[model samples]
Target: MGKKLFIPGPIDVRKEVLEKMSTPMIGHRGGDASTLQKSISEKLQKLFYTDSTILLSTSSGTGLMEGSIRCSTLKKAAIFSSGAFGDRWYKMAIANNVPADLFKVEDGKAIDIEMVEKVLSTGEYDVITITHNETSTGVRNPIEEIGDIIKKYDDIIYCVDAVSSAGGIKIEVDKIGIDICVTSVQKALGLPPGMSICTFSQRAIERAKQISHRGIYFDLLAMYEYILKKDYQYPSTPSLSHMFALDFQLDEILKEGLDNRFKRHEDMANLVRDWSRKHFEIFTDENHLSNTLTVIKNTKGINVSNLNKKLQERGYQIANGYGDLKEKTFRISHMGDYTLDDINELLDNIEDILGLLNKVY
Candidate 1:
């Protein structure tokens, strides 16, 4: 049996969406490709709530996240981390030899607005990176509130990793003054992994001009320039297959209505949260719980791998805790096209396996 995916990313893509990937190949630099890219960009504007330039990269979301820092920051980057993914951004800065500092909140807790403001007040940082939703910890930071503080400093570039949240959650990228917002197709877009997208503001373009290295492959400025010059084409050969799938997926997403889609994700997440509290504890705080995934603490100290084995037998697959949290917690994703009834079935199976139906926790 093909197990259903309830993991953080590469979530269950609909059969129709997958079919789009089988679309006939097109010339990356041809007019046909331009039309496809343009269609996807316009739809993405609707998704991101931004009038800024939308740039598509034929790489994972990490590609754009790295470019955001390397290309846009002329001074130092202040990276605020909530969990493993957040920490990865900080590591990227160091590995690239970018002048950066990393600060983190209490494990699994969201970054508070006040905490962000305290760091920004120093004026020592030229850009700040925030993870809108951290998959590893199942914590959703208050990017809206953080944006309010960041607005006070016009020069600081605000980069957000919305990799796990974007299409699944409503984030008004422009309203929040996010200079660069990154998200991948594999997460909430209900598409296979490969292509990633981001909104690139004019401010970021100008900032990129000031930075020297700004690596070539993932250069944000290069991407923005190419899109403008070629009229919705990328500097390098693009992922035409993913573009075909993305264009189709965007149409489906719009038809469903963005608000309704977000609510659906929320409803699924809430069900998982309630189920977790009834048996295992939620790894993150209630106020900061992610609407896309729930990480449940192993309060019962069950063997996570064994549980996954049982789940696989029943044709469902979930995620183990990431990094150090492995075995300490287990995650159930509620993102993409997953519905409430789908969540119910998964939970029913989990309860039965854990014997929780008879108070097995």
Candidate 2:
């Protein structure tokens, strides 16, 4: 039996989603391509809750993250990070020669409004990036509160990395005043990886036009103009496989009903939270736990590697701690097509292993 993935991403793709990737190839510049891409763009606009034009990339979500900040920022950037992925945004900025500063809260803590306001009010910064969900520490930043905070400063561009939380959680892009919002296919979208999709606003377009050296390939303005001219076709060749699956998987997601899907994720998260509380403690604060995954503190200090080995034999797999949190924490994902029954079964198996280890040999 294939081991079920409870990892943050490249999460267990549904059988139908997997098959969509095998769809026969198509011409990227042909009329058929326009029809396919245009259809996907329209659906994505509804998914993102915005009227802004959709921008699709042939790379991971990181590509858009790099492009958005580099292309649109006229001055320095203040990147607010709560965990590892959040830290990456700051690193991406510096690597691209963008003047940037990272303001981070302690691990396992969410970024607060006070820190955000302090940084933005400095008057030295013109752009800001917030990781909506930081997978490393299992913290989902309060984007609604943060978005409200950002809107107060009209000149500061608001960008969000919703990579792990977008489809699993509800994010209203236009209502939140997010100028650029990015996400990929693998996580809660229940599809295979390879491409990323983001929303681009008119204000962001104007900023990109002012920035001259925005690098090749990731140049946001070049992409937006091409799509506007070609009617949703990307400048370079696109990933038809990922796009095909995305179109189909989105249909499945919408058919399931957005509210129902969010509720399913909530119910599964609650089940894991209850289980984690019973056996191990949750790593992040209760107020900001992620709806898609739970990072459990190794309260008992068991050998996590051995535990995973046993889990594999039971036909399931979860993620070990990331970065500096290694061995100190373990993550169990309840995202994608996974159900409540799957969570219960996985927990029962974990209970059996914990019981055996507790027994005196």
Itemize residue pairs with steric clashes in candidate 1: none
Please, what are the lDDT tens digits per residue for candidate 2 over residues 1-361?
A: 5689898998888889899999999999988898889889888888889999899899999999999999978989899999899999999998999999989899999998998888888899888999988999899888889889888887888899999988888989999989999998889888878888889988888888889899878888899899889977888998999989999988888899888888999999999999898778999989999999899998889888898999998888888899888899999988888889988888888889879446631
> How many backbone clashes are present in model 1?
0
Against the reference, the lDDT scores of all candidates come to 0.91, 0.89
In model 2, what is the error at residue 29, expressed in angstroms? 0.5
The local lDDT score (0 to 100) that residue 249 gets in candidate 1 is 97
What is the per-residue lDDT of model 1 for residues 92-148, given as tens digits with 9 covering 90 to 100? 898889999998987789997787889899989999999999998999999999888
lDDT of 2 at 86: 93
What clash pairs does model 2 have?
none
